[model samples]
Target: MSWLRALKATARSGLTVERRRLEPLVAARAALGLALVVGATLALFGPGAAISSAFGAFQAAIATFQRSWRPRPTLALASGASLAVSTFLGYVTGAGTHPGPFLALLAVWTFLSGLAWAAGPTIGIIASSNVAMMLVTVTLPTSVAAAAGHAAMIAVGGVVQAALVVLLPVRRWGAQRDALADALAAEADYARRLRQDPVAPFDPVPLMTARSAAAVTPRQARSRPAELHGARGLAERIRPVLASLADPAVGAPAEGPQRDRVRELLAAAASVLDAAAHAIRHGEPVDLPPGAVAALRTPDTVAILDGPPRRAAVRLAALLDDVVETAEPRTETRTPTPTETRTQTPTAAGAQTRTQTASQSQSQPKSRARPTLLRLAPVVAARMRAELRPDSPVFRHAVRVTAVTTAGYVLGSALPLGHGYWAPMASVMVMRPDFSQTYSRSVARFGGTLVGVALATAVVEVADPGVYASASLAVACAFGMYLLMRTGYAVSQVCVAAYVVFLLGMGGSAWTQTVYERVVLTLLGGVLAMLAYAVYPAWETPRLRGRLADWLVTDGRYAASVVAHYANPAGHVCADVREALLDTRAARIAWQEALDRATHEPVRHRGLSRAAADDAGHALAQFGRVAMLMEAHLPERGAPPVPAAATLAEALRRSTERGGKAVRERRVPEWDELRETVANSGPLMTDPLLRKGAGLLLDALDDLSESLAPPTDRA
Candidate 1:
């Protein structure tokens, strides 16, 4: 019953659709790609070639529809090339006389391809396509000449799929822009909550998700639109200021024009942020309310504001100025000199000017010039080196996949089961780098295959579909597979299984026997994948401590950098601050990922209880808010540094180092001594607002320390 409930929950969550607009587009592209390949093959080489080409086309279409946030044409070409090469190799090996050498070759290919997962989703999908192609190719019997021809046909199929991608490039920047808008909207909501209640607990999920979406390689950042960069930077700058403004001790003058003016300013700032978000999302002009800009510059506004509120106003002004700059285009104009006007007739002068303009345009660099592989060499090298390490999960998973697939292949061949390659293919699909995904996928694949086999068998028995009807069924299933691939593994697998069954039926296989063989072989492969994981798993709990420690260290560095900026406010340190922030964001992302993986694992594999883990996560989130507040209030030029700023900085670094060690050692550190030091440090600076902000920081740090301590008693 528990298992049934879990399955039901999984289906419900997986089937829930967001972004409905994109689904039909994806499904259409996939179906069209398949249709083109089948149609071309049937016209050029007849029905037999069409049947073979349909298999290649289905694989290519799957690769095409694998959604990536950053879509690159080069990635599509590379995927096609990989599928071609892998299919050729599989055909050659299967045609050989000896089974031992063929198995050895398969193992080596599986291991090498599995390592590609570390490079990211695009490369991972290409690798998976290679494996899928190989599984199908090895089942066919062909001579070397026939194999080469088939490989060329398969390459053509991939090219057609890639062409479809290039022809329709909708929503290229939609995901990135939407993410930035959501971040700004979240910040605006946070500000509103602060205005309503100064002590509301902040939820960091939206900001974190946005940051994750905004993260890109240096190469990507350089190529992205200037407006997007400005929006993200401005949103990050606004967050910390909002946190500072929420401090209750930052008081406004009571019952006066000043109080009313400050309240109005805060409201205006929030509205401006919301407007900026809307402008960015919709690509429309950002126009501030009539008096909003004038209000910021008014005498009353400056007179009433001080400390945190003043700082907030300054940041808000800067953000609005940036919005205006990005929204307006700049054009340079020049006047003709007296000598130039006198030297020629009007027509001659106009022609000369046109020639100069054309020459200048010709000299300018082209933005669309192809990105050289030389530029990517270093990144590829670094990823390869990282995955080569013995302790890397990618390396371990590669080895595990190689071993499992090899054993499955050997077992299938020894048994008298028809279509033995299905067993290894199942194993290939189910295995993943993480334990939880591998387990979940194994279950989903098996269950979905069973359901799919039953449906396919029933349809074939009732209709007795000929080649044309079977081909139509295959194409429809291909479309459905790509549509639900991202939405749910189980549902996608159902489509995949049905498509394969129809594809085989088109090649004149007995429907009932083919279905029986597929069900048995898939079940065997799934069980093998699960067993492999159980024997050698990459459990997340053991790595969680290290991930948490890494986050602490990076957060400490970011906090330290912010404090140092106050001591030497004149120094130009924006680059250093930005780098530190990026590092902190990266570390936070890693910690969150590790925690999520741990949550999915069984209790026996988890080092900490779920409740304890949740408590620690909450503590870390609170600490992040305090860090943002400290960063928000860096001293301006000629402004005096808080007297206790240096002391607080030192304490923060020491406490973070201590906390990291405690996590690494899996034991509690003594926080009483640090608590006493912070309590006795006294009034934290001259400005009442800075003092209050420091007090909040100390309280957050204390909470973090307490959370790191072990529970007093466990059941």
Candidate 2:
């Protein structure tokens, strides 16, 4: 009986996991199948080609509807309106081959079928791509029998694909949750190690946190809706999961050795949430306390909290050990070593002293708010205009990128290779400025195509003579592709390939036996795309370096502004102060990422470019730390404590205009006096009310100027 219970438990767990994994794929399949079936069924009642063409017209209508709802919808009624008109035009152009009036009628229905809100743009793009292909089929004659056969096939295919998708939906949110948890755990471990030693030479905590946080932001944003709306209503279910974190009972640690560890983990998670919230609210970066690293590394600490958990336990344990190891100082236990053991008193003391000095050196501490007048737009816009003028290097670079890629594509399309098909695709694949992004797209394309082809082949084998089976297969393929759309390249390739293959088979192709030819064509397209990417790669370093520089420059300016305002009285002080503080925070994060990418390959990005990116990132982060200190002291924006702050601000502004390197060198006017006044203003910052307004700025000015200094080539 005990054994039987164990078996039951195992079976239940296995089934749950399997179901979770397959849900998203199932949903995609179902959507694809449904769309295909509807189109194919319409074909059975008319000439198969005419019905297919009409369905294409419907797709175009949907696409138009989608594009109409962007950046605030205008006078346009729906995307489908354009599709209907286009279909009519196509029909008119081929009136000698097919009745122009029938084509016009087909256009109206297509338009009506595509009126979905929010999804029109994406659907419209898909629709437009196929519209031309479908219009070509207008040459074929139409009748009730052909349309009926087409419609029936489409309906069947849609049903089957939709069934599959609904039955085996993919677990996108679950994956996101897992990723989020891992990122948090890694950062926590790093912090914990930092805590143990407090003084050992340590890796900067903010850098790792920034990277992890970066990854989490995009995933979290993407997963939010899916979690709210996905299959089994998992999204709805996860709402409570996110809420449960707020509940003291859910995230709080039970008392024991692991209690502290647990609290740290919870704090880390909270930090992530806070960072995400701040980014959304004020568009600023969230920086965690270095101590959070220790808590993340402890396995016993991480294992207790388990909701939508995957690998959280193992990661937690490893993180804890790592923290303990990295932060802990090395001590030499000199056991009485034979003859040499007795003479160690003075030497041991000296070694101990040296170790203490090294440890102290390592623990050095490294390193918000509200809305403002929307009226800063003119001032900001002017600044933007000056900064973004076309004569600058930035505009020149942008134009160059556009021209190169456009030229590459035109050349490819014009070439004879792969019947002029491989060239255009090649141009897109090869000429992308971002190699990684381009590669990812290419991989997705190939994989998606393969999966599509396989599915199409299966449907063809099962499809019977006449139009019903053909239409059904086509519908099924469409639904499947739609459902598996998010997972990456493979899913995309599978659906598209399958749908096209099914369409070919349904149209009664003698080429059904020549499957290899289709495969070769796709391969050829992928190869060309890869080649285009390799020939003239646009390295991501230059843009990344520029962003880093911009962030630092902006941060320094914001710091000075906040300080100046604190030194003087102003209206809308809180509003103004918060705006400056938040701006600093935001620029800091942008700087860090740019720094990381710029420094990722030192060999590839050398000399001035490398130094510029690195110095800028560090400077911004340091400047941010200063701003945080200021904000902490001055909660209010309007109070002025120190009169000298305004003078200091003027000096800093001049230095900033000269650039960070100059500012770091103390080259600005009245630099020494400003520094002295800010340093001496500490006592004034301690007053409760005055501290909230004026003291903050003084602290910020002093800290920021120092933090933005560049690193040396010290051994």
- Candidate 2, residues 114-199, lDDT tens digits: the string is 22111222432433233333233333334434333333332333234424433444442333334333433434343344233221
Predicted structure with the largest TM-score when compared to the true one: 1
Q: Which one is best on lDDT?
A: 1
Model 1 segments beyond 4 Å from truth?
1-22, 46-57, 64-67, 94-96, 197-229, 249-275, 284-305, 324-378, 570-573, 605-607, 641-651, 671-694, 713-715
Give the C-alpha miss distance for residue 657 in model 2, angstroms: 3.9
Assess each prediction's global lDDT (C-alpha) against the native: 0.66, 0.38
| Clash-forming residue pairs, model 1 | none
